[model samples]
Target chain A: MGKYLSFSIIAIKHGYKNKGETIARFAFYGIILLVFSSLWNAVGSEKIGLKPRDMIWYLAMTEWIVLSYPLIHTAIQEDIRTGNVAYLLTRPIPYIWVKFFEGMGTLLLRMLILAFAGFGFAYFITGGLPTNPLGLLLYFPVGIFASMVVTLYQSIIGLFSFWLQDATPIYWIFSKCNFILGGMMLPLDIYPEWLQKIAMLTPFSSFLYLPVKACLELDASLLLEALIKLTVWAVIGLIAMQLIYLRGVKKLNVNGG
Target chain B: MNLKNNYEFFTHLLKINLKSLTSLRGAFLLQATFMIINNLVFFTMWWVFFKKFKSIKGWEITDLCALYGVVAFVFGVSVIFFGGVRSLAKMIDGGDLDVYLTQPKNTLFYASSSQSHASGWGDVVSGIILLWFSGYLTFGSLPLMLTVLFCSFVVFVCIGILFNSLAFWMGPMDSLARQFYDFVVTFSIYPQVIFSQFLKMILFTVIPGGFIGHLPVSLLREFSWSNLGFLVVGSAGFFILSVVVFNRGLKKYESGNRFIGVGTN
Candidate 1:
């Protein structure tokens, strides 16, 4: 626990040092929020069932999840390719746990910065806050769980670098799946029934769609269901990461790393 | 350099890029395939959107398809033909400009044409497919559509060069450059009528998203001599401006005292 806390501090420092990049990213997110606000305001009507404000705020939540996650895949892929994982393995701490805490440190800071930026922009455009501010405050823990699921999934994808010469194309596919199925661009409920059903079945929905949906609507039953699904997905992702790491490390050892 | 010499150099670079990509045949194919599928997944969002709302403002699903098709094609052509534009920030920041500077050819052209992106072929393919699927492809409209697409291609590449050239002055502006590039891309695929009058003005001039996203669709759907003129002039103006900015920025590059290396000797 102490080691993880120390690693988290290091990651926080790293995040702080890259303030320029963070500001640029904030600008990007803000611009995207503005564009979406204009789009939703223009298109949203009585028939669409979503208010412009709600839709924009929902997008804020979703985009936060998409943009704020640590680029764990790149880190893992680089370590594997350059044989840095060999040196990392010699450390007293376990590699995956170290990465987890490091990722948490960066992810928390990014989430807060981007959320504030996005929410501020949404408020400026819509002239109001989320309908359920209390629910939103409550949704923070659920959001953290969702982030863990996404990070663990990324770790699994990154570990594939040991076998694949380049895991980027694979990660691209995974990201696209997360974008479409995860409801980063639109609410899953807005999708066709068949597509919505398919999306809900996937872990992508638990990673992004469920958490955002829970926050926006703030239904007690929905929140509970989303939490349960997120927990299940988190467990599955952790198991997958552990299994992949074990195999990847064994392969690296056999290759004389 | 003369047009003939430029053409020869581009073809030479294309040949080498193709060779390097084909060397890793499986990875190349997989990358292209994934890119195409990725595009299709994005398209699905629009599919669901139109299914729900039917149309946004005056734009319908068919219009959305055309927008995506044109934007993707323009982006693909820029990357496939002038792949080096995407790497401009990294090259400039890393002091890798020394080689291009020393070369006798046009530095910007050399820098942009030095690499090829295999996934761009996927975009080109999917873009054509989308255009055909959208029912906008007709014998009567083909010529005009081609011209507009060409203009869009010019504007896209110019915008990329314009943004990436920031590295020359600011030093190591990869993230900022990429975000601006992404801004152009994200806004270019949406319906332009959604933007307020002020935002529309900015889009037309500063970001130039209006040229590639809105104007082409308008000109294609309803022939407008004024819009067509704007498209042509705007493309030319932006292209010239990009060249000027890149040349000016080149003067600021400090080389960082790094060893200059080109392709394997």
Candidate 2:
């Protein structure tokens, strides 16, 4: 635990040395959320009659998906390109656990920082704040579970680099596919009935929407459904990741150090 | 007599570069993947935007797709053909110019061409798909569509050179170029209508983002002489400026500088 924690923290510290680019990325995302939040707030009031409190709920709930989602791309790309996977393999800790936890650690810090920034930006723009204390209570666990779903999905794709030489193109395909299914771009609830049915079969929605729904509506029946869905997807993700890891390691004679 | 030799030298240089990348499969494949990913991301961004607004500033899915398609196709071609532009600073800094300069070729031509980005090649495919989709929706004549695509090709070269010449003055340019690419890409995903007057001017004259997709796209939407004029002039000006800047930077290069090497600089 100590070793993996230190590894994850040190990676962040090393990465922070070149803080300008990352700061810009965080700011870029912040700008997108701000622009959309302001637009949606006005549109919601004018068109859909959603209240300010509901706006805040949307903002807070989507935070995990927006911030941590990019990390899914970055973590996978970096680990493969830098050959850091080999370093993790050298560690005494089980490679999968180390990767899983280290990813959690890095993403946790990124999500917290970006979420706070997104919240501040959303608040100033919309003058909206979460209405319910229970939404606040459920937010943390939902965030953790959502992030886990993202990390696992991303790492599985990243590890494919061992076989394919470069995984970004494929990752792009899957990640965009995730945007539709995961409800990262738009809520599954809003999708057409057919699309919604298809979306449910995929685990992407479990990554972003389930958490957001839990936080925003405080919909108890929906929460129960989300929990079940999350558990099932998490298990499937674990199985898939295991198969990917085994295949990737066997094919790991890639030329670059 | 020397001029004749210089022409021969450039031909030989092109032949060599063509040979080099032909054998480098891994890098090419990786580059192709990166380009495809970029295309997918924009597809998502636009899909969601179109979903939310029903329309953004009088634009539809077809319009956005056209803009994205042109940008993607143009940018992909630029990257594939001018890949070395992204590496200009590092190549200059690391004294790698020794390799290019010693060959009896125009250093600029040799440097710019045969820098194929594999990922961009993949993007080219997706770009074609989007372009075809948009054209099928809006364009009535196939020949006219082909003519505009050719203009878009010119925009590709012009904007690429304009952006690449920045490696002359910028530091650690890989990231700078990346930021530039990101900025161009993000804004390009939307209709140009929402841009303020000042920004619209910047896009038209300075950055030539207008020509990159907007002008030709407008033509596709509604044939207009003014839009074509904007496209032609903007592309010509930026293309000229970038070449001049690159030549100016080339003169300042100290080909064998050791300080810019790993240990010293």
List TM-scores for all candidates, in order: 0.95, 0.79
lDDT (Cα) of model 1: 0.84
- Per-residue CA lDDT of model 2 for A1-257, tens digit only, reads 68878867865665556565666556666556544554454345334344655654565556545556434445655666787877767777766666666677667666666666766665665566666657756877777777777777777777777766566666766766676777774566666677788778888777777767766778888778888888888888899999988777666644532
Candidate 2, B100-121: lDDT as tens digits: 7665566766777647566667
Candidate 2's displacement at residue A31, Å, is 4.2
Q: Please state how well chain A of candidate 1 matches the true chain A, as a TM-score.
A: 0.95
State the TM-score for model 2.
0.79
Give the top-scoring candidate (TM-score).
Answer: 1
Model 1, span B1-265: residue lDDT tens: 7899989988999999989988988878987888788788779888988887878888999998899989888888888899998899999999887887788999899999998988898888888888888788789899999999999999999998999998877877887787788888888988888989998998888788889878988887788899999999999999999999999988888785444345545
**Backbone steric clashes in candidate 2, count:** 6
In order, candidate lDDTs are 0.84, 0.66
Candidate 2 clash pair list: A182-A204, B31-B118, B31-B119, B32-B118, B32-B119, B33-B119
Steric overlap count per candidate: 0, 6
Clashing pairs in 1: none
TM-score of chain B of each: 0.95, 0.78
